[model samples]
Target: MAASTAQNTTGATGRTTTNTTIRRDTRTLPAAALGPENPLPPLLPRNDPHRVSEEQRATLPAEMARQIGYAPLTTVLPTRIRDGYTRERVPTAVDVIVIENDRLRATVLPGYGGRVHSLLHKPTGRELLYTNPVLQPADFALNGAWFSGGIEWNIGATGHTTLSCAPVHAAVVPAPDGGPMLRLWEWERLRDTPFQVDLWLPEGSDFLHAGVRIRNPHETTVPVYWWSNTAVPETEGTRVLVPAEQTWHFGYQRGLRLIPTPRWEGTDHSFPLRGTYPADHFYEVPAAARKWIAALDETGTGLVQTSTGALRGRKLFVWGAGPGGRRWQRWLTEPGSAGYAEIQAGLARTQLEHVPLPAGAELSWVEAYGPLSADPAATHGPDWARARAEAEERLTEALPAAELDAAHAAWLPHADLAPTETLHAGSGWGALEVASGGHELPGTPFDPGTLGSEQRPWLELLDAGRFPEPAAGAVPGPSLVSPAWRDRLECAPGGPLTDYHLGVAQWHAGDRAQARRSWERSVAAAPSPWPLRCLAVADGCEGHLDAAAERAGRALDLALDAAAPAAPAAALAALAREAVPALLAAGRAAEAGRALDRLPAAIRAAGRFRLLESRVLLAQGRQDAARAVFEAGFEVADLREGDEALTETWAALTDDPLPEHYEFRMRPS
Candidate 1:
């Protein structure tokens, strides 16, 4: 789908400019299809175990302390893991919306979580952001399927986002500067909040202005997290500058510490390539200082991002110069792609904390993206203060703080205007929220026309007073764990399906006993594998390792049985992955081997399965066979950030140094 709208602007010389355009188009790139999401329910808790130092925690104000770590996710229920994507790349067409003026062009991917795919400076023919050559999905996202590069809007917890591989609604609207604006809006599931991003390029202006708004329509306060992460090309001389003397450093060791800026560990860490490992630096910008961060190249010309006062924090994340970091970089995209670093702005001082948003209230801010030019000597100088001052002055000259404030004021009223034309359609979940809660969101409407199959059961529960059960062997729908949904599920008549979903909701609410009873009733009513799997998770959470292993094995067998086709092969493989680990934990190595042998040839041939195969082999005392698994060159696309399982497994196999392909350690030993 393609549509265009142009605005004519009269300049000071009484000349009319007629080429300010906002249009929708398509771009074909070498991309991998993000296949289906895992069908099984998330039975375990998904708490963030990242540690913070006492020094870091002591510095937090009262309000920040109260809001930090609030509403930790019990499970990623209702959202599923997207592990079906492989490393295979083919030419695929992706939807893009271009917001352009005479000076710059901002191309956005609405179907891919409203990511700013490319920011081009028209005058210099330069791409300001790190535009990836291929769209390869990786396991960096909270719900899986994340690609590197460009600017991404992360709204859920401390990972990439649940919507990293999903879509959002997009439309064309009027900009505050009388030009056309491209609007992207979605209902964030994790926080149950509605948010919108408005992108526009002022006529002949150098900056691309973005106005962001997040609303909490509930009667109670909600924990909110928002970060705009921008990826920029990193080179030997590229330096990141922010007006700060100190920072909070968080490494993969899972500890945060206060450290001096620019120079650390006998090297200037602002140059990303100088570091030996991946890490995060949350710059402690003073309250009165200008809120801006800039990344300048060797010539002192690159991108600068400046926002209003509401967006308070700035951070720099580097992949570093280590081979493990390099392997991760190559894994995310093409091996030959230029290295990149992330400069991020968030509401909290660090991504580990979440701020509180009052009920019936909204938070809004304006950000400007444009080119910055400074003296190479000053920006790359040994004096950190001098480099920061130079960058700040250049940013002020490019886009004044007062002008950005004025832009925010001008955009407040326009943010409530209805979208003029729809460009793309997203999921039906937002409309279901609107229909259930009767939320009066004005500008970003959740039209009933957008509802689809994923939301049908919940819609029936809302309208018909019963949760409709699907036919046997049909794929299960997502689980809703909110209080309102729980109340509805509890009030409905009990059955196999109702009891199963009710158990999930109860478990998320921390009512373990009731959840167990509900699942037991579900199994009694219908002896299926899902509820039994839930019981296994409960058993594992407690210390009943034997019972957990037995239940897990049963679930795997039932899921894979031809008579009971409850889940797809991908979901069955996920079940096997979990069950084999449980069996190994219970000292049932021979049973784990038997389970692996029972799997279909194609399912057992996956990369993740190959890693599991090595684990099973090691448990069976077959060290040689286990070593061959790593030598076969398999990649675990879904390997988590802090997971050291691969390294531990390899160490057990041999005493030699870990190989480069298997080395993904982000921290020092």
Candidate 2:
């Protein structure tokens, strides 16, 4: 790493400051220093017979092999290099760095997920961000264990990206405005992408500004997701304010649904108004030049998060005051761990929507988290925004005009310094669209009444049975399984979907016995519909018609019974395609007919589903009906001629047999 320092003098304020190299050092503290701990066993060495790879068996040290099933093989862990582990209170050390100005101070844990662990308001002696009292790990991350609190940068594929729990490279750089800045970054191996975030605390400022950059270093375009997650203490009157027109809900048993925010009667879902069931949902804030979200406590003091550049979405997740929430708190922290709510912002409109990062392209953005003054009487959406704006204006007026202009140019060049666009008072479900340009300043004549309808045209098209043709490429086949896929499966487990991928890898490797075992374990563990559908495909390939029908029926039943916030529209279509064929082959023609008839019209109209319908019709000795269905599908959209499983299954049904294997895209966890 290289070091750089600079000094600049401000003429207006007659103040001089020097930007020095970011200082990094190590500090030792008690292992339980952050919080209490009902420490679970070390996360490795679970007795899963299928987990022992040939490489591990061949290269294991004698000592490691002896404790393979009893203790964690710390040295072989993918992310962290653990010095040691203890069940009781023990001394632990981590790399720490600090960046501060006159009014605010931030502590960065470079070795522990590069988390901004502590943000303090020097004048008030208040910790503006929630600080976890203990450094405990829990099974919350995609790779099994993660620590809570602080602002975690989630990149790559969802659910706390791989780097969330791992150490990242850090450095101190002088901000363009001559302020102290801390930069931390890591290369994500799975996506072949590199991401970096610069944390800048300008002199005498209360806000901590973060600039993020993500680059796709691969030759091909890839799907990517980015979110900044911050945990804040939740008090009785804690409220979350998001400047969005509508909200979308997705979770276990909750099918995809849209609703109005803040004004939901009986229960104000906008904030922690009343504690009932656990509420975990994502809200899509239409793209606006001035994007902001905040969480305030009873005393009116809280954190306000604003972003510029490519980030466009915001999410609020609260573990309610129920038993499940309590259990989750225990799992994530020690005995005295306070209940906290997460305020998250993302790069896309919704988590389910994948944003494409073109090859060799980069995305850049800035997000600022600052202290918000309390307004005890401000409870509604408009009131909260008003109070926040006033506080922001006070800070702006206190800074030198030149420095303010330079700072605005540095992070928000495209956005004008203005109050957010006016929001409509009326409520209704509508298509959540991204805003076209930057937020308009207040007092500028603008219409708040007719922003737009809530109905989404793209969603309406999907509902109308029109799907865009698949991208031009051979649908990835099982035969194309590579070493990278195997490594990913090995590194990430504990999810039914990951298990399904493992089964797919095993099947492709010519190991049916292990494949079946893996699939069975997957369903036993989570019962998500994906693995069941895969098992049905395997049974069909083996000519076990009766067993195939049974599995396929179960898959359909589970999917249909799910209270999915949004229909797993694509997944359901795939399931219908597989189940119809199996049901027909098992001599259950009536059941097969019912299965096809029950599919949503929009789904049944899809090219893939129509193909499956045609196959079922042909199997029932109705060639004319099958031909009509096939032609109708083509009329809807020109079918992309790929999908090895569909092609092979159609061939086998037509007495034109091909090699047998299951194929599906891996879903992000």
- What TM-score goes with each of the models? 0.97, 0.53
lDDT of each: 0.87, 0.56
* lDDT by residue for model 2 (461-489), tens: 22342212222211211111224444445
* lDDT over C-alpha atoms for residue 29 of model 2: 48
Per-residue accuracy of model 1 over 174-250 as CA lDDT, tens digit each:
77766567899999988899999999876667898999999999999988899999999999989999989999888
lDDT of 2 at 55: 54
| lDDT (C-alpha) at residue 526 in model 2 | 69
lDDT (C-alpha) at residue 490 in model 2: 50
Instruction: Find the candidate with the highest lDDT and give its number.
Output: 1
Candidate 1 worst ten-residue window by lDDT: 9-18
